[model samples]
Each structure stands twice: as C-alpha cells, then as structure tokens.
Target: MCGILAVFGCSDNSQAKRARIVELSRRLRHRGPDWSGLHCHEDCYLAHQRLAIVDPASGDQPLYNQDKTVVVTVNGEIYNHKELRAQLKSHTFRTGSDCEVIAHLYEEHGENFVGMLDGMFSFVLLDTRDKSFIAARDAIGITPLYIGWGLDEMKALSDDCERFTYLLPGHIYSSKQGGLRRWYNPTWYSEQIPSTPYDPLVLRGAFEKAVIKRLMTDVPFGVLLSGGLDSSLVAAVASRHLADAEAACQWGSQLHTFCIGLKGSPDTKAAREVADYLGTRHHEFHFTIQEGIDALEEAPNKEEFHQETCQKIKALHLYDCLRANKSTSAWGVEARVPFLDKEFINIAMSIDPEWKMIRPDLGRIEKWILRNAFDDEKNPYLPKHILYRQKEQFSDGVGYSWIDGLKDHANKQVTDSMLMNASFVYPENTPTTKEAYYYRTIFEKFFPKNAARSTVPGGPSVACSTAKAVEWDASWSKNLDPSGRAALGVHAAAYEETGNTEAANLMNGSPQKRLEMLDENCNSCLIEDIVASASCGWHMFVALWEKLLTTKEGNWLHKQNEIVPYKFVFLFSKTFLKGNIKYL
Candidate 1:
C-alpha cells in the first residue's frame, strides 16, 4: 500500500505550488515510507509515497506511459496487472508496477479506464498532453482516498478530505467537466434488484479471489493479524497467497508476516499459531500497556485508524515498522488486508444482517460472513473452531483492562465536570466519555475548529456502525460503554474451546535461542548504533526491542525471563547490587 495526494486543475503558479504538493504529501508518508515521487504539469501535481509491492526494478511511480504523457501516483496493488498488460495490444510498457497500467489505460479509455481490472487502489493520473486528470479509490475502499477542493473563496476539500469531499471508493473523477462518476459498480450495489444471492460457493470463490488479487506485490509483504476472525482470515489468506506466489516465481520473495500486541496480549499468541501453520516467516512485536498508553498521544506508527478500538493500535503501525525505511526487491513489498478491501466489503455490506448476526447461524460477530466465506483449503489461517469465532472489538483485545485503564486514566485527567458540561467542550458529538474527551482534546491540537469536524459523523452508535444498527440492538441504549467486552460470551467461548495454548509455548527452547540472538541480532544492534548518534536510551531500547522481539527468538527471550534460574537470576543479581531495588 502507498499514500497518494494530488492538487489538480492548478490555475495557480504550478512550479511554485510543487512544494505545496510535497508538503501535503508529507502528511501521508506514514502510509508509504519506501520512497516518494511528485509529478507536476502546467496545471496539476500528483504526489506518491510508495510502499512498493511489485516490479520493484522499474516500479518507482508517477509511473508514466512510454512518452510520459499520462503520469500516475497510486496507493494500492493491481494483482491482475500482468493480465491488464496483456490486454493492452498497443501501448509500450514502462515499469512492472501493477500501477503502470493506469497511465496506458487513461491514454486509451479516458475516464472509463477504471473498470477493467481487479485490485485495491487509490490513484491520481495527471495528463499534461491530454490536459486532463483522473482520480479514483478502490472498490470497497480497502484503500483510502480523501477528495478535497479549496479555492480560498470556496473550499472543496478539508485537510484529509474531511472538509468538502468523502471517501470516493470505486469511483473516478475527471478534470474534464464530468466530475466524479463511479465506474466499478458491483451487481449487488448498482443493479436495481441486485440478484447477487448468497451462495457459500460463490461467496467463497469471490472472497478467495479478492484475497489473492490483493496479494499482487513485488516486495516483501505480511499480514496484520488481530487474532479476530477478520484479521485471522486475512492473515491466513495472505500467508497462503504469498506461498503460492513465491512458489510460482522461483527465487523471488519470502512472504514475511507481521503482527503486534502488548506483552501477553491475546493476539500475539493466536497470531503465532496462524503463522506457523501457514509456514510463513512470521514476526511478532510486543508493546507494554504503558507503551500503548503512550502511543495514544503520538502519531500512530503510520496514520489512519478511526480509533475504532482506541488509539494508535492500527494497520499503519505494523506497516511502518516493517517497510518504513526499506525499499522493495524486484517484487514490490505491499501490506495487504483482504478484509479491508472494497471488492470484498461490497459483498459483505450487501448481505442482510441476519446472515452475519451472531447466533445459531454464525454467532454474532460482525465479520462472520467474511471468515465463513472461505472453504477449507482456501482458509487455513484459522482452524474451523477459530474460523467462525465471534469478533473481539479492539478495545477489549488490548486487554479487558485496557478500556477500563483508558477510561480511568481519562477520568483522572479529564474530570467528570468537564464531561457533565461536554457541550461546551464540543458542541458536536458532545464528548460522551472521558477517553473521548481526551482524544478530542488532542484532536484539537492538529485540527482546531475545522469544517472537517462536521464530516466526522457524530450522534450515538455503540461500536462502529451507522446510528441505525445501534437502534436495532436495545442493549446498546442501556450501555454507554462500546467495548467488545460487552460481547462477553463470544470471546469467552472461543478461547474456552480452541484455546490454542500452543502459541504461548514459545519460551521452551527455540525462544531462548532467539533471544540469545538479540545479543547479536544485526537489525537490533544497527538500530542501537544509529540511535547512539542521537535520541536517548529509551528510544534505542524500544527500537532495538521492536526488531528483536518480532522474531521467534524474541518470544523466547520473554519466555526465558520467566525462568528466574536463567535470565531472571542475572536480573535479580543486577537488581540486588542496585540498592534501590525493592523486594516485594
């Protein structure tokens, strides 16, 4: 994935405005940390932060047609780019990027260029010769595009498309008068009486294809496993997808998967097993609850989490850590989340709630349909026992105590009197909880009195939903808390049943060896060496530890610490020498 930003129809000083595009694009570097490119014409500028995933040799983007007429900076992968290339009987190919097809297609099909492929993408193509531009987002919005326009006299877009525009998923806009028109309309959403019936077989087929399609990348890639069904299935599908791709490509890529959690967090253990079963080069990272607490005030490892769970813990975090400073091999490295893609969700949102509602049918997790939409061979990331597992909202996964901790922390910092008179603090959405008030306070730091504030939907919804879903469930009205902990039985029953304790067994032998490697780990020591040039001890330790523990050996270190006779004995002796060490 990459971050894309653009300023089109620039009647302003186009050359001087180049810096503005770069400045705006800087805000999105968290999304595409590999490299960046900006293409400026007489009237437009397109900027890209690339998370290169395919054809890395020539995949530096703002990838243009042979003559450099149509230029594009894209954010997602086109898995079927090879096919799309074959379909182009005439145009000369440039880079091996799944993104390059856009320039050629724009040259041939104009705005209609959007419908011919399968992939998750948000892109801006600027045509100097053609004197036109086109922008669009992926079908299900798996990728993100925020459209904005501001003329000083009139504002078309706020900061992050929060002002005047919305997420234009699966739609295209042209500078040629016919503004934004959607091209990829799934039969389910576009047809008057959509007959896209729920066939387990069809759904299964589509889901697998969606995952496989999204896996198109030329760089090292991995999964974001939350241990929930959505993340798990995504990880599973991704592991398999990478496996197949690697095998077919000879000596091309190694599918490395990554996951993050707090110390002893539930997701870490669950993710380990999924990684091993799929035979991926798995990496796991651990953070303390205190660290998560600290992250609340920092920009996420990447940006963009609706804070659907809480704060900072997000898709961008894993991506930033893994590829932030790295470039891709010939194959570009892309982080794929099948569950988040638009093509997949289009089917999901269309199905009736009864099909997805947890109960005897599937149990009441929201993405139930997403997990079951796969067959056995297609979905091995989770065992069937875990496959149909109900959702665990993020607030709960961080720890049952996480929400309570956040709320308690918020209460201490943001007094009840403040919430009692929240309307004064926020006339809109009127801060309901102490935690919200805290986030709102921070939000004000970056965005103070924004027109975009209106774009962020308010009013009541227990979890992530439109207000309508909350009205359907009476329990929501009675409870102010939106943590998934409310769905007690679901998480309880899954852990109680499949409770794959094997994942926690990392400490036995291999884990210690892994930790021992930390003593010599190249990635860690290098980071330490770099940090020594600046920063501080905590930064060095945190950075080194991030790389160290993401390895299996890292888990072993955590395990080794448990056996006091070994690592802890040394720790105890060291502490014993320090007079300040307290015996509890």
Candidate 2:
C-alpha cells in the first residue's frame, strides 16, 4: 500500500508541473518499486511511491517536520509508531518513519490529528506556515486514496487527470475546511445490534493485538496462507509471536508462510498443514491454469457474513481492500491484514451480533467466535482439525480445477455472440460469465475509459457472495459459481484430503519433469557460483601476495621469493575444463 499522489491548487506550478508530477508519479510505479518521492510546495503536489517498509534507511517518503514546517506523503502502517515517538518528546523526528509521526502529529494535534493515527494509512499533509492542507483515510480504507479534479480527472492514475474520486474511508480532507470530514466514528458505526458479551478472553485479546500490531516490520514479512480460517489465524498468530518480533531481529525466528496453489491444491494441502503445524518456513507456489490465464494476460493486478461481516468490512475499501492493496503492491509486497485490523475491527465488531451467527443450535460453526478464540487447550493455537477448518473459497482454495480452467478457457474465448452482447458490450459492469467476459477483455485492454469502467466491482457473486448475499441463497441466485466449489460442500469435504505421499509425488510431478528439475537446480547454482568465484579469486591473490611482502618493492620481492623457490606453474588453461587443473 505505498503509492500516493497529491495535488492541490495547481495552475501548473512550473518546470512542466514538476515534469507532470514526475509523469503522474509514474503511474504509481507498480505501487512502489522501492522508491521515488516528490514534495514540491508552490502549488502543492506531494507524490511518493516508496515501498520500504519502516526505515528502509531513513524511511524515504515525503516526510519532514522539525523546522521544516510540516509536510507528509505516507501511504500506510504507523502501528502506534513507537507510541507516537513517545508522544513526540517535543518533536524533532526527521525519519525512522512510521510515517514520521505525520509531521509531528500535524504539528501537535491540529486538524485533530487524523484521529491520532494507529495503522493502515493514506496521508498527505503540508503546512509551510498557513498554506494549510490535509487528507486522510485509514480507519478501514486500509490504504488507497484517489481524489482528482484536475490533470483532467486522473485517467485511472493520470494521463492528464480529468477527474478522480475514492477518498472516503473514515475520511478527512481540509485545506482549511473546504470539504470532506468524517474522521472515523466508531461504536460500530451505529447500525445498532452489538451487545458486547462474548468474551473469549476479550476476543482472544483483540486478535492477539491484531496480530501483534501487524508485526511492526522493518521488512521481510509473510503469511497469506489460504489454509483459510482467516489465513490460518494469520499463520497461527504469526507463528506464535515470531520469536518476539523486531521482525525477528532481521527476518528470522522462522515464519514465512505464503501459498498460491493448484497442483494437489486445497490451498496446497491446507497450507502444508498450517506450515507443518506452525513451524513455518513454507513457500509453495505451483500455478498452472494456463499459469492462471497467463498471469491474467500478463499484468499487475471475497466474502460476507455477520451483518455480512459489517457489510463486508465496509466494502473492504472496495473488494478485499482493493485486492489486498493492489495485489501485494504488485509485488513489492506489504500486505498486513490481521483481519483488517483497526482495533481488531473495533473488537470484532463489538461482538453480540448473536455471537456472530451460524448457530447450528449451539455448536456455532462459522468463525465460531474465531474458532473459540484460538481454542488453545494448553499451547494449541490450531489443529482441532485445523481449528474446525471449513471455508476455502479462494477459488476453491486454488484447485477445483481452477474454476474449471477458467470456465474452459472462457468457453473457448467467449463466443455465443459474446454472451448475447454482454449488455451491449459492457454497458458498465456487464460481463455475466465466460469468465466474466474473459476478464472483461483483459480489463478493456488496460483500462479503456468511462472512468476506468466505473471502478470495476460488478454484480452477482456466489461463493464470494454479495449481490445482496446473492439474495441469501435460492440456489445462490441460480449458481453464479464464484468457486468455493459453487456453494461449499466444504469442497467435497476437503476434496480427498491428500497432503503427504511425498507431497503427492511432488505435487503430481512431471511438467517436463519439473523443467528437468529446474534445469538441474540451475546448473547446481551455476557450479556453486563458479566455485565461490574461484575461491574468491584465490583469496584475493593471497591478499595481493601479502601486500607485496609489506612493500619496499615487496622487500626485494620477498628476498627473491625465498631464494627462488617459486615455480608457481599454475598455468594450464584450455579454458581449464576436465577436472579443473589442480596442480598445486
């Protein structure tokens, strides 16, 4: 979640509007391919694209505060920034950014310091003495902001931004109060119904402090296992508090997790049985469904229940918080969801929506209050048949023959008069199957206008529910099949289980014998990096012959090389092949 673009009152503030805001923040350079920031003030433009999770060397962003008169740029993560830098001990933090305490909490609580931030953000500050400004977004937007009125609305991000919108998720936009406000009002945003109660140790201590405040992070993070049950209770409470994380002193205390699937799937056998019961170092990728439709024609880029999970967590920014923040920031990776933390969704949505429904007359199944709050019977965070494992969905947990190979390759490339003129060729969210009109013709060949097809989210959903919960089942509005094996019979009761048998013969082997065992493990790691770079160039040529025998013409060439005993005849080279010439 690191790609921001801010522009205020610009009537073209020069050097071609800072080279058109560095060419519209290079269309969010795949959500931050490591770095790129821009702050310019004269007409207010605060761009940033940095994905350096927490202090990647001085935390690069638009930040700045001390006598620099407040400025910010942020995208997300501020997990109580070391308790807001111990309440800004008289403010002077120019970076170790958990977003440099939002320009010293807006110069010590100004526009009410965006509700004293916590985690998941979408900033934009700037003050520079009274030239005032603001922008906010987290209480659940989870990170993504978007507001345009110029650059002609921001053609999807900015081809001369003609007009843009999305900036409302616990809002706040000021510029001296000229508009937006709603800065996150909780108490379960009032639609009545919560009665608190259900305290399995206060909902397992607010989901283990929302998965240990998203493990704060200085980098190397993981856990996206679709072993389900909210990513296997976020990888069993981050592999049980990953050795007391400071990102386990530089990515260690062994918790890696991942998953992706389809070769003996059910989310790679329940994420390799919860990464072999939480010892985690898992990985597992596997692909194939025409490599997920050629990685979706090659390019970057779920659920409801319980007040339909608070209207799908307030429409998760707009679909799983914009596909988990632009599909893991397209790959620069930074996904922290801890069930979309925000004070563990206000203490699991202030409980008592009948103990989150699905009763089955008392053996309450669905999330059974988060599997009876980590049902830990003496250090057991999982393994009660994987905490009563049930929901899979992520396209049938990766396999059900991958949505029947994307509906038999979109019914052999969408014909039958293109599904009867798919509402006159996508008359806004049209695609009613043929795998959603072959992924809306690869998203209209990369966003063909109409405000990028009215920002996507179309109708009907089945296993991925909501078209009013697909009218709460009448054969789910006639089977839309969004894939938990189209209405979950628990994917054929965990589709013939199968995990071991050498991981089912290495996931049903032979894709040209796994590309000849990955080209024999890349020629055995390129011959062990060419024999450790020829033993580090023969130990830097014996430390340059012992620093030329400690100089003075190498002490007369080391006393004529110890009285001419130097037959250094190591010269065999017909590209030194057969047993690599070792005459010593």
Candidate 3:
C-alpha cells in the first residue's frame, strides 16, 4: 500500500519536475505515511510514499532490479509474489517483500511482468537507460489510477492515450509496445458460454485459490470483517490458514482484524460477531456519524465529486487508523479484500444479470452467488441472517446519515440560481444537487486547472458502473445519488422498507425484529475502548514496573510481543503519564 507519482517524457528542468511529483505524491501522504523516496533521471521522475505492508524494516519503494537496470514504484499487494519468485529463481533477487518480484520478472521478460503475479497493484517501472516507464492498474481498477497530461514532453508516444498513462493491470509497458496488454481471460468472459449450470465447486476452488494467492505480502495481515459474508469469508479463510500453519509448524503468523463504523452502525455489530466466530484478535473503532462525516470533510482527496471524495476519505481513514494501531507491523498483517479480487470478480460478474440479481435461499444481494460459489450451507463467521442480509450500498454501510449529511451540505452550498447556470458554466457534470455543487465548487478550487480533474472518469450511473451503462436504466437520469441506495427497486425488501433511503439491516432479522443486534456489538466495543484505555493507562505501567522487577507472568507486558514504537509510546508515556498505550 503506497502512492507513486511519475513524470515521464518531460523536457526540461528534471529536478523541477521531480519536485512537483514529490508534492503530488505527498498529496497521498495518508496512503503511505511511513516512508518516502524519489528516483530521478533526465527524462523521468518517480516519487513514492511508502506504507510498509511487506518487509517493514527493509522494503521501500523506487525498488530496483539487480544491478539497477529497472526501477518501479508500486501501490498494492502482490499475493503470488513468492510463487513468482520461485519461478524466476534464475534471476538474482533481493528483499523479502512481495513487490521485489516485479523487478526480477521485468528482468526475465521485460514486459511480461504482469503475466506472473496475482494481486491488485498499480505501478510504474522506469528503465532509465531506455528512457521509458511501464505503467499499469489492476484488472478491476480496485486500486485506483488516473492519467492526465499538461503537455507532452517527448515525441508523443504514438497511439498512447496520453503521454501521462494510467496502466491497466495484467499488462506491462515498455518504451516498446507503447501501452498495456491485457493478460486475464477466462471461459466465462469469452463468447462461448456452454453453461453447464455453472459448476459451484469450480467457482469455490477458484475463490479459495484467489484468496490464498492474495495472501502473499510479507507483513502482518488481517481481514476487515464487516460481519457480512464477503468480509467474514475472508477473515475465516485467513484465520484457518494462520491456525493450520501454526499447528503444523512450531509457529506461524498472526492475524489481527479491524472494523470501523458509526456507533451503532450495522457494520460494527456484524464485524464483531464475525471476529468472535472466527476466534481472531479484533480491533473495533466505533465512530459517530459526526466523526465519520468530519473525517470525510477533512480528508485530503483533492477530488471534488462528493461521492468520489467520500470514497477516498474512507480509504484514507482506514489506512491512517491502521497506522495508529500499528496492526500491520505488530501482527505482520497485509490486508486483502477477496470480494474485490479480480479473479473472483470475473466469475461473480459473468453470471447473466438476472441470475446475479436473484436472492438465493438467504434473501440478500450476492448471497446466492456466494453460497453457490462457496458450496457452504452457511459461512461459519457470518450469522445466517447477516450472511443473507440485503443490499446495502458501500456508502450507506458507513452510516445512514452520512449520505443525507453530504446532500444537505451540498444543498446549502449551491443555490437554485447557481444550479440554473450550471449547464452554461460547467456543461460537463453540471451540479444537480447542492451536495454535488458543493463538491464541484471544492474541486474547482483545488484543481482550477482542467487536466488534473478530468483524469477522474465521471458521469452518471444509478450505481458505480461505467457511465455508458446509464442507458440501461432511465431512472439513472432521474436520480443523482451515486450510492447503491439509489437502486431501491433492484435491491431487496429492506431497501423497499426504507423507502429507498438506506438498506434495512438484518443482522438477525428485519430491522423491526433485530434492532437490538443492529446496535449491539459496536456499542459494546465503544464501551470497551473507554474502559480499556483507562485501565491500560495505569495498570499497564504497573505491569511495566513488574517486568523490570522480575521475570514472571505478571510481567507479561515485557515478554509478550514488543515492537519499539509500542514500547516507546508505553515507557515514554509513563514518563508523562497522560494516556494509556493501546496495543495488541
């Protein structure tokens, strides 16, 4: 997890361009707050912000191939890196990090690097001597990338969409082919569909393999269990793997899961239930609607579309909070969302839209697909009701009131008179709601220049499908809300019950019946934090003293895994004695 900003094909003042790229990548400080690095040559500049997911002590970006022939900056996990490393054993290798495989693969088959790995990654590899850079985004674009051009610095790379490129994943770049090459193709995606009832076991195996492959990072890792099927399944599989490895070997890796939501949010409850069911160490952050909204407002997305900004804000908070907790390094955890994995997605997306929409035995969106694909009576982690819960838009999952708040904020910012002139002034994506206008106004303020903002593809869809898909439904035009909450007719009964404002949660059952479960886990987690922080503040220091006094169980704080940052904060804080040191 990191940020890379590359300026290639630029003409003059290479140092000047390097400075700009450094500033631009710094904009992603929230993504990779731990370390920063830069690589510069005559025509190319690459700047990286590092989040040490793999090889925390040694691995940092602007990584180079043996002898420094190839250099790259990567921003996502590579799950099959070790396997790829084994395959490319003939090449000299360095670093325990999963991403080191890219440099080696590039050395073996310059542009074939994408064919060898399975993970979500966006990267730019620079060949200084060749005066070129390779760029690519993952197959599903699960990890975001954008390309824009102020002007071409070199002979316009012919047929290249722009001198500034957003590389598509599963493809490699060269100063050679000049662009991306797609490497993923399965039977489902092709024209021949000899549907033999879509073998459930095959789908199941593919998913398990996908999950395993995505587990490649060298750092501590855990699942973000929302207690929903997707998240729970990931957590369950991960926990099972860690347990098996530990029992078989003398030791194994640790998994520490994390979940966050507004106090009393449906997600908080589900995540905790799933965590306990999996029997994994878990960290829960229960925020208020105001906290989530405030985080969104203060987040440094630079993008102005409120929906897009909100997405960036949430991702930013997740990364930052994880850093604060030191969960990644403490537990050697590298996070992956199997639900977002491309191989899994291809199977999930290929079903005829009708079958995909059916509520399996458990009346929920995607439940049938997951149940059928996993061949499970029920996922062990999710409560049967939550596993089969209805369609809740990703945005709404954060908080029901967040969308309403954003809309209200937008409304107050843009007047009816201003909306009337939108078409004349902006013409493209002119503000429909005041919320949108408020976002656009912010966007215009930050990105007063046209090129930077246009890089983010935008238009309209009931949900987040490509803008072209808008033609499939006329309601898309009638509604401006980008959250899935906009699609009430398509969602399950819960959506219908909410009059389409939000999905009705069913951690146990309908909102009316299971209101208790909906608010239970998170409220308890909040109560726990207050108590634990207070206890750790005083008792933990006393424990630290016990450790200095003797080597007994009472001194477990010293013997139990101690990372420098955690211990320093603890001992240092005792010197000041204000707050408790929170740790695993």
Candidate 4:
C-alpha cells in the first residue's frame, strides 16, 4: 500500500498551497517510506508516497502518460497491470511500474478504464490539458481515499487538511460532475441467495486461483495466520501453491507466515501449530499488554487510521482484509488473503448459505463445511482440533488481558464527568464507555474536525454482528461492546438445555411424533421452541430405530418405508442421515 493525496479546482494554486499540500501529505509517509513524488498543475496538486512493492527501482508515483497530459498518483498494487499493458500496446510507458499502465489506460479509455483495472487502489488522475480531475477507489475500498470540503469552493479544492471525509468505496468523484457517483456494483449487493449447487472441489479451485492471483507481486510476501478458519485456509492454500515446482522456482523458498499476540496467547499457540504444519518460516511476535496500550495511545498516521476503519465497515464481506493488510504492511511486507480473492468469494457465496451455518449438536461447528473439505485422513491440511477450533476475535485471541488492560487504562484516564458529558463533547457518536471516551479524546487531538470523527464507525456491535443481524435475536441490541464475549447469551444459549425436555423429545421423535407436536402446538410455538424440539426428536428417533432394529422388528424398517410415501420418506431420510453421519 502507498499514500495518495490530491486537490483540484483550488482558487489559489499558489506556492503556499502546494507547500501545505506537501506537508499534509507527509502525514501518510509511514505508509510509503521508500520514495515521494509530487505533481503540481495549474489548478490541481497530486502527491504520492511510494512503498516500492512492485517495480521498486523504477515505479515511482505521479506517473504520466506518453504526452504527460494525464498524470496519476496511486496508492495500491495493480495485480493485472501486465494484462492491461498488453491491451494498451500502442501507448508508450515511461516507468516499469505496474501503476504506470493506469495512466495509459486512462488515456485510452478515459473514465471507464477504472473498471478494467483489477487490484486494490485509490487514485487521483489529472487531465492537465483541461485542468479537470477524476478520483476513484478500488471496488472494495482496499486502498483508502478521503475527500474534504473547505470553507468555500476554492478553499474546498485547495485545502489538504484532516477535516476531510472518507471517500466512499467503489465510487468516482469527478470535477466535471461536482459530485460522487457509484461505479462499482456487484449483483450480490442485492442480497440475492445464489442457486448454485455446493461443490467442494469447485469452491476449493476458486480459492486456489484467488491465492495464485495475489501471488503476482515481485517482492517477498507472507500470510497472516491468526489461527482462525479464514486465515488458516488462506495459509493452507498459499502453502500448497508455494509448494508447486513453478511457484517454488519463483519464490525460491518456503512461504513465510507471521502472527502477533501477547506471549502464550491463544492465537500465538494456534498460529504456531498451523505454521509448523504448513512448513512455513514462522515468525511469532509478542507484545506486552502495556505495549499494546502504548501502541494504541501512540496513534498512527491519519491515512492508516482511516484506512483501517473503512476496511472494517465496507469490506465486511471479506471480514479480515484491512486487518491482514495493516498487520503485514506495518512491517513493509505485502500480505495476501486467499479468502478475499474475488473468484473465491464469488464461488463461496454461491454455495448455499445453509452449508455455512453451525449445527453444534450434530458435531458441525462454525465453518464445518470448510473444515470437512480439508479433513483428509491420508493428507490432512490441518490438525483435527485446529481445524475445528472455536472462533476467537483478534483482540481476545491476543491475550484477553490486552483488552482488559486497555479498559483499565481508559477507566483511569476518563473520569465519570467526561463520560457523562460525552454527548455534549462529541454528539456525532457519543462515547458510551471510558475506553471509547479515552480513545476519542486522543483521536480528537489529531483529528478535531467533525468530518474526521464521522469517518469512524460507532454504535453497539454485538459479537461482530451487523445491525441487521440483531434481527436474529432481539437481545443482541442490548449489548454495546463489539467483543465476541458480549454475545454471551446469544451463542451460549444455543448449547443450553431449554428446560423443556418433554417438548424437545416430542419434537425429536419420528415423523409421527413431529407431526403430532406440530399439530398440537403450531399456533403458539416459537422458533427456538421448534428448533429445540426438532433436534431432540431427531436424536431420539435414531436411538429408537437402533433399539427397534435389534428387537424382532428387523423387518419394521422395510414395512415403514413401504407405508411412507417414497418422496416424503426420502426427504426425512436425507435429513436424518446428514444429522447422524459424520462426513469427515
């Protein structure tokens, strides 16, 4: 990742404004420490800080087209630059940078070229001939971009200040239109359930391809294994690919995997197991609880902060893209997440959502389908326990004490008076706890403007559940903390005995019992009541079948099958078979 900043249509394109732009852009220098470039036109300014991941020696930013009439500054890797360059054969390129292809493409296709590029990026392209500009971000907002308005039209175009607002992901802002327009809209955004059949091999192939595509970098790269299913799967696929003779010839070594946590943390231990299994060169970094607090206290650059926040809100589909990027990029290492690969995501989402749901009583936990896919006895991808490990939030996995320590520190710093008057101090998102108040206080120090604060997400998040998820359980709305532990009753209750075993047993019985219960209680039954009853009844049906089969009723099965309609019996048989059998 790199840093990009630009201003267009400023009333005063004066030396002072240019200098101020340079100084403001300096705030993002950490994101790109290798090189810096600036492009100042008659009515606009664009600046870039280069991280040097691709074409390190020659791919500096503020790249230009053949005639230098179109200049562009980018803050992301263009994975398909070679293919794009192949399409733009007639255009002459100045630098070997993958990003340089963007300028030529813009020249060739104009504003429509943004969709042709495949990668994570936010860029500002200036049409120096007309003094007009167009700014756009990646389809998923993997690269951060912010736009701010100043006191007036001229000031708005001139100011490169912290007061800027986050540029919406998958959007384009043009000087000609003077507003934002949506440029990226996938069909899945409509919340349509896919009708594709669940094929494990197809799903696996898509994921493998995604991992392969992300391996386009010339520099050394690694996977961030948090010991979670998503990260573990990414590590697994990348390791398998890296083991390929061709890939090994290119990378020249085993894949490197990294994980960070407090010493002896759950993630540290789990990540070690995965790295060892993958035969990766694993690096485990430990930070003290105090050190974690200090890092948060020493707030990083503004661009970094904004990018992290935007990634969480917009890229919820991927879930861990920003975190994985931020963690690895901090050390100048490019991280790839196979799970977020576009092809992998499309295939995974196409599979019926029912396959992803957790059914603990049936020995099917969260991501059970994924675990079962790789649960090969002869060539297992991961240890059974590791494959089936319960999910843990990143903060909680990095030693529970880390979050507890932060809360303690926040409590000590933020007085009761401050929390009580939180609304008045910052009404946009009133702080509900001392921890939030303390953090907001520090955030306000660097970004005092309301727009900056608005960029940050607020409101109660229950166990990573979005606002819509609260509809699944009303009690979820009562929680304020985003930590997984806060969803105590919601998840824990799923395993608890509902204290109505009679009802449960009746529901769990054979088709006859289930029909009787539904007929008896259909008018007043709750979903939980029905689910509990059905689960118990199913187990009971299996036990009764075994008992009856051992008796003189060995022929009872055939008789029952004959009595029940073939189609109805087939549906019931499939349900019971899936619940009773252990596939992996």
Clash numbers, per candidate = 23, 13, 14, 5
Give a tens-digit lDDT track for model 1, residues 1-584: 56677776666755557767677775555445567887777767777766544665568867898898778888766767788888898989866777888888877877786878666677777778766777776665544455674111011133434455344456777778668777766544532332244556656656667666655543323454556555566556655565576433632344455555545556566667666766756666655434444433331110111221111112221121122111110012233544444555455445443454345443444444455565366535467756655445544543444455445555657876888998976887676877667656654544453664543445554543334444545666556664535533545633221122332332210111211101222332233212111111112223333355446644643553332111110000000000110000
Candidate 1 vs 2: which has more lDDT: 2
Q: Can you write out model 2's per-residue Cα lDDT over 223-333, one digit (the tens) per residue? A: 657676666776787778879977688657877665656668766787798789888776565655444443333300012344555665666566555544554454445
Runs with alpha carbons beyond 4 Å of true place in candidate 1: 9-16, 149-164, 190-198, 247-256, 279-281, 299-334, 340-382, 487-584
**Sliding window of 10 residues with minimal summed lDDT for model 3:** 568-577
- Each prediction's TM-score against the native? 0.71, 0.31, 0.69, 0.75
TM-score of 1: 0.71
Worst 10 residues of 4 by lDDT: 565-574
- What tens-digit string does per-residue lDDT give for candidate 3 at 319-436? 2222222222122122354544566655644544333333436453444656545446655534566656654543455445545554554454567899888888777656566655
Candidate lDDT values, in order: 0.50, 0.61, 0.49, 0.57
Candidate 3 segments exceeding 4 Å error: 9-28, 148-165, 168-171, 179-196, 245-255, 299-335, 346-366, 375-381, 465-477, 486-584
- Candidate 4, residue 437: how far the Cα is off, in Å: 1.3
TM-score of 3: 0.69
Candidate 4, residues 1-584, lDDT tens digits: the string is 76677766779888887887777666556456677788888767788877776666788888999999999998777778889988887988888898899889888887888878777777888888887788887776655566763111111222345556657777888888888888876654444554566677777667667666676654545565667666777777777776553435645557766566656667778899988888977766665544444344322232332232333445442223333333223333344444444555556655655555556667767567667776778977777777877766565665555555556666667889989998998888787988667656655644455655555665555544444444445556676554555555422212222233331332221111111111222211121111211111122222222233344423332342232111000001111110111111
Q: Give candidates' CA RMSD values in order.
A: 12.9, 28.9, 12.9, 19.9
Which candidate model has the greater TM-score, 1 or 2? Answer: 1
Question: How many residue-pair clashes does candidate 4 contain?
Answer: 5
Colliding pairs, model 4: 150-156, 508-536, 508-537, 508-538, 509-537
